[model samples]
Target chain A: MDPDRQSELNALRPDLLRFARLQLRDAGAAEDAVQETLLAALTGSHRFESRSSYKTWLISILRNKIVDTIRSQSRELSASSLADDDAGDDLLDDALFDRRGHWQASARPGRWGDPEASFEQQQFWNVFEACLDRLPAKTARVFMMREFLGLETEEICKETGISSSNCWVVLHRARLGLRTCLETNWFAGAGT
Target chain B: MLSCQRATELMSQEQDRPLSLAERFGLRLHVLICAGCNNYRRQMAVLRAACRRFGSLGGQ
Candidate 1:
């Protein structure tokens, strides 16, 4: 391998790891995906056409690896029999929203100051990945399957064995949780 | 009347599936009147953009 290319590949590992972990929701599987992606990228380095930035190209490769993982997991086993576990959201919703289904005063979304600025900061991504890591595993997977992988709601519901309503509910929780997490970790002290 | 909770579910569903006319009306009406739900809707938009940023080196 060319030395410069090798070092560049090494530098991309953490970003790739974060992406894989969010997509796979399992550290071991994430590591495998990143490793495989790196290997494939190196082997196919000559094929690079400079059409996209290096990171984007690498992510495209990582995305395929992730899809393969999702496919294998689906074929090998049943959809998460963890549907019963989905009920835990009742506790979360009860505490955060009022009887009338309004935000508890304390739980309303505050202004997120300068989210565009945060997108430029590498540290913001670290916080983003950490918050994503904090979500309940299944919720994170379903959320990524929908948002990151761009899967349809019906496809996510079919894959997760949850009803369309349940799948929507899970996605709702994920968005709320991620927003809260970002607020606490990045936006709160930064300002409105 | 759409509660914040119901409006949010519709907001979420709107992302994946097309909302029925009634559902869109309820969500729009509630969000227009409710600041918190309005903020919640914006927050989800930011979150979606952030996720896309993570996937692409595409500058925002």
Candidate 2:
């Protein structure tokens, strides 16, 4: 690889690692996935079409590593998740809603005012990433599987060893958590 | 009428599966009355769209 290409690859490590860490939820495994992805990219550097292949190409490679690790980790994954959440995803949800099942006085959702405009803003993406990171590990994993990887709900159920309803609950909590997080950290107070 | 909590759940689940007639009815009724749940529902949709965009954001 040219020195410029080598430097470029090095720059992508953090983004790739962040993605792996969230998907695998095990720091060591996440590290290994990123390492493998880098190695693959380095060896297959010739395959890249040049100019545009940077993180997009690396992400595709990383996705494979992430899915592979998830498959192998399936047997052990069940230990962390349950048919109903005991993983504290609901702990926050419980507090956000009153006993009457209404939004609390302080927790109501606020208008985001055309969120698409913020997509071009780096600060918005930063807040989005922070919100994703705030989710419980299990909740984040399930959310990514469905929303990021586009995995079917049944596929996620099989992988996580949880029931369909449980899977829905996890994803629900993730959406709620992320929505509230984005609101508090970005939309509601960002003066959007 | 569905509670805000239950309405939110239905909205979330609708992404994964089609809501039954009763669920649709309850959510439609609840959302028509409650501004908070309506906002929550819209935010969840925005959240989903943002996630799709965010997934690719790492690529750059």
> How would you encode candidate 2's per-residue C-alpha lDDT over B1-60 as one tens digit per residue?
677888888999999999999999989988898888888888888888887776765422
Per-residue accuracy of model 1 over A144-172 as CA lDDT, tens digit each: 88878888887876765678877777788
Candidate 2 C-alpha lDDT tens digits along A89-148: 567767789898888989987778998787778788878887888887777888998987
Query: iRMS of candidate 2, one decimal?
Result: 1.9
TM-score of each: 0.86, 0.86
Measured with C-alpha atoms, the lDDT of residue A116 in candidate 2 is 74
lDDT (0 to 1) per candidate: 0.78, 0.80
Report the C-alpha displacement of residue A25, candidate 1, in angstroms.
Answer: 3.5
List, for all models, the DockQ compared with the true complex. 0.61, 0.65
Candidate 2 chain A lDDT trough over 10 residues, lowest sum: A76-85
**Model 2: number of clashes?**
0
